[model samples]
Target chain A: MINRTRYLTQSVAKILIWIGALSTIAMMILILFQILREGLPVLHLGFFLDSPKNMGREGGIFTTIVGTVALTAVAIIVGAPLGVGTAIFLREYTRESKTSRVIRFGTDCLAGVPSIIFGLFGFVFFVIRLNMGWSILSGGLTLAAMILPTVISTAEESIKTIPSSYREVSYSLGGTRWQTITRVVLPSALPGIFTGILLSIGRSIGETAAIILTAGSSLVMPTSLFSPSRTMSVHFYILAREGISMKMAYGTGAALILLVLMVNIIAQWLINRYIRHRT
Target chain B: MAMKEKIIEKILLLTAFSSIFILGLITFFIFKEGLPLILKIGIKAFLLGEKWIPSKGLFGVFPMIVSSFWVTFGALLLGIPLGLACAIFLSELIPPSVGLLLRPAIQLLAAIPSVIYGFWGLIVLVPLIQNHFGGPGLSILAGSLVLGFMILPTIITISEDSLKALPPTYKAGALALGATHWQTIWRVLIPAARSGVVASVILGMGRAIGETMAMIMILGNAVKMPTSFLDSARTLTTNIGIEMGYASGDHRQALFATGVVLFFIIMALNTLAISLSRRRVH
Candidate 1:
């Protein structure tokens, strides 16, 4: 009788677990499907080519797209070098010491600081204090700070995976430390590091709070680093919030989703290829 | 060559310290902007006073603080079960091939912007809640549901990692001792991985609390204390996000003070999570 009850309990528990897992997956699919169904019709070539008009009630999101691209480019250019250098220092130049631990703790804490806090800092320090005004430079620098921890951690993890024997081989071959890192370790870690950069790009593309504060919500085409601009995420937020035009919001959201999807797909493919090649 | 290596090392070390330097500057500026207001109003009045009118010089954030906790608590209630289920499913129940496919799907869920989530909540969830629950669609309930989903990836990924990190002998020994699969998971494996699972939940709480744009979209800008999930409310993040554009003088300082409170809360949670995970490692 006890054994019978045990089997029944297990079966019931299993069913509940299956329901929980399936519902989560179903919810994800439903969100994706609902957005795409409403959004795909609005996406066209013109939507990508023309700038907005009439407070974003009409016209396309071309300027927002440019803003997103420029902002992401600046973030990657500034953030990637700093992040990879930090990772290299952590993994190659330092041992497990107080200094390394403090740096790691700082990175982790920075990761936990919310995006809005970064926006506040950018507004005060970059926009006001530094006299950058509401421009792409301020916004991009804030995003770089926001994505710094992610890049550092990913780069460090990848660098840590490179076999020590490779470094030993380089040294035995009379290669300098700089030469070994540049030619051997970094090359082997490229796929992983590249994946991190891709992930950061995706993040920079979607960030809204920091962008709106530091970049200013200008719908005009961003001509230079000093010009104020609007990103797609910020554009979507304003449209949907103020009830400007639901259709344009859907289009912008669709475009943003597609961009993120493309990034994740590329990152996943790279990771899979790297694993396969390694094995 | 040696000299070149030394120079490169110095550069890298400077880079390594950049994050710390940036963090210090962020804290310093936020406090510098915020601390004067707090001192002027008194910390107790700023934190515990119920009113938050910036124009009249009332700058208390008690209601927002309450709403932030309530919304985050509601999110945790919904997210923890779903996340644990998915984590267990990925770590134990599913085949590796199936898990591989599902894993990226979760990562993609994370990659989807918070604004998109906010958009979805606005379009679909608010109306659903209004029609069925008999309240304005923009309630704490709406915010919670959206945030619940937003935090899934954080909870699932970390919990699954901890579960996967367990020694194989644990499962084998439990089974060999005649424990059923469910029994082994519930009585042995989960108990063993408790620290990690707890850490994931804490981190999820941090994410839910720190979330801004989505809450600003779904949670209506009611400043009064929320008595129920049906009432519209605002969070600390939404407060800062909504008002920063037009706010100046004491009002602007008040928003930064709000951010100061948020910053401390997140740092505390992060330190707790790090300590918990460190315990798991040993």
Candidate 2:
């Protein structure tokens, strides 16, 4: 009787677990289906080429695309160096000492700091105190700061995975520490570092709150670093929030989803290639 | 050559400290703008006062705080069970090939932006709730459902890793003793991975609390204190996100003060999560 009861409990638990797993999968598919169903038909050549007309009720998201590209470029350019450098210092230069521990703690804390708080800081410091105004420069700098921990941790993890023999070989060849890093270490760690950069790009592309605060949702095409601009995420947000144009909102949302999908796919490909190459 | 190397090392050292420096600056600026309001309004009134009228100089965030708490609680209530189950399914129940396919789908859930999730909530989830359950649709219940899913990846990934980290001996020993798979998982493995599972929940709670754009989109931004799951309410993050656009003077500072509270709360949760994970390691 006890054995039968145990079997019954096992069957029930198995069913519940399957339900949990299936529901999560179902949620993902449902969301993607709902979004793409509404969003995909709106996509076209003109949709990618034309700039917005009334508020965001009509026209393509070309300007927002440009703004996104420029902002992400500045972010990657600024963030990648600092993040990779920190990783190098932590992994290559320092042992697991007090200073390294402190740095790691700071990075972890920074990772947990909410994006909205970053927005408030950006609005106050970048937009006001620094007088950079609500421009690409201000927004990009804030995003760079926001993505630092992600870049740092990814870079550090990749660097940690580099076999110690590689470093030993460089030292035996009488290469300087700097020479070894820039030549052997960096090249070997390139795939992982590149993957981190792609991940940061994906993050910067989707960031809305911080961009809206520091970038100041302007419809005009930005001609300079200091010019205010809007991003696709922010544009979709405004369109959805103001009840301006559901059609356009769906289009923009669809576009944002496609862009994220592409980034993830590319990142996945890179990881797979790296793994295969290693093995 | 050695001189150049020395200079490069120094530069790298500066970069290594950049995160710390940035954290300091963020704290400094937020506190600088926010502290005066907390002092002026008195901590008690600012934090506990019910009304949040900025024009009349009333800057109470009590409602927002309460809403944040309830929304986070509701999210965890929905998320924890599903997330734990998913984690267990991934770690133990599923075949490797199936797990591989499902894992990326889960990560993609996280990869999708918060704004998109909110948009989905606004369009689909809100209407469903309104039609089915009553209330204005954009209730705390809607927000929780959306956030509950948004936090699934975090909870599942961490919990799965913790569960996977356990020795196979535990399972083998349980099975050899005639314990079924369910009994082994329920009575043995889960207890062993307890700290990690707890840490995942705590971390998920932090994510739920810190979420902004999604909450702003779905919560209906009602300033009044929330009474139930069906009530529309504003959270602290949304409070800042919605108001900071045009707020100036004391009103602006009040938003920063809200940020200060959020900052402290996130830090506390992060510390707790870190310590919990550390205990698991030991």
Candidate 3:
């Protein structure tokens, strides 16, 4: 009788667990379905290429798309080198130093600070003090700061995972430390580095608060780095908050989700391919 | 040959060392921009002042601070148990194939952008609460619920890993002693994984406090202190995002002051989390 009871309980527990797991999947499908249901009718070629004007319902998100791409590009350009540099320092150069430990602590602290705080800092330091004045440059720099910790941590992990044998082989070939890092170690870890970059790009694309604060919501296509611009995420927020047509908001939202999803899929594929190739 | 190699090595070392300077620059910029505002506002007024009106130079961040803590605490209250239970089910009770499907689904939930969450909360959740509870569409309850779902993945993933890491012998020992599976989980697995569970909770709290877009959208952006769970409230993150756009003069500084306070709170939480995890590592 006890054995039967135990089996019954286990079966019940398994059912419960399955229910919990399925609920999450169901939620995601529901969200995607809702978004497509509301958003699909409005999606068009013009919607992707047109700029926002006349209360944003009639106009498309061309400028916002361009602005997002520009800001992300600039952020990657500015942040990637620094992040990779920091990672190299942590893993290869100062593996056990007090200064590196402090750097690691500070990086971790920076990572945990809220995105909104980064916005405030960006507003004061970049927009005002540096006189960038809520332009693309300010927004990009802010995003660079926001994503630095992510890049550093991911890069560091990737670097750490590179087998010591690769480094030893390079050294045996009489390669200098720099050569070993630049060639053997980094090549082995290239996929992880790319993964970090892709993750940062996804984060930058989805970011709303930091950009809204630092990047002024000018609906026009940015003329230059110093000019104000609106990103898709920011546009989505504005449309949602200002009581625009729900159809328009959903349309823009679907576009935003699609963009992120595409990037995520591509990045995951690239990382997987790289892993397979290396193996 | 020796000289050339030495020079190249020095250059590589210099490039590596520059990261230290970059980290320093980040901290310096944060404090440099934020400290003066704190000094001018006076720490007492900044912490305790009721009103946040910046026109007359009163920059009290107390209400925002209260709201931040309130939302975080509320989220923790809801998310921790559900997340832990989910983790327990995943780690202990579930079959391998089911665990695999569930794990990715949880990650996908985490990967969904906060803006989508805000939209979902606005359209679906806020109305549900308002219809039942009779308040404005935006309320602390809405914020907590949205944030609870947002941080659920964090807690679940961390707690699941911790539970998974427990020695199999521990479970067997309990089973041999005639403890039921549920009893062993409640009495043995949980206690043994206490530190990790604590870390997961802290991490969840950190995410909750830091979250901006969804909270801002759902919390009604009310600047006043919350009177009840149904009352609308603003958090430090939302306040910063809302005001940072047009703020100038003392108002801007006050925003930076808010950032400073947020920075310290997160810093403290992260330190605690790291130390706890390090202890477990040792």
Q: Which stretches of candidate 2 lie over 4 Å from their true place?
A: none
Best by DockQ: 1
Cand 1, B chain, TM: 0.99
Candidate 1, residue B27: how far the Cα is off, in Å? 0.7
**Candidate achieving the largest TM-score:** 1
Per-residue CA lDDT of model 3 for A137-167, tens digit only, reads 9999989887888788888888987888889
lDDT of 2 by residue, A96-215 (tens): 899998998888888888899999888889989999999999999999998999899878878888898999999999999999999889999999899889889999998999999999
lDDT of 2 by residue, B232-256 (tens): 9999999999999999999999999
Task: Give the DockQ (2 decimals) of all models.
Answer: 0.82, 0.79, 0.45
Give the Å error, residue A271, model 1. Answer: 1.3
Clashing pairs in 3: none
lDDT of each: 0.93, 0.93, 0.82
Question: Which run of 10 residues does model 2 chain B get worst, by summed lDDT?
Answer: B99-108
Q: List native contact recovery per candidate, as a fraction of 1.
A: 0.76, 0.77, 0.41
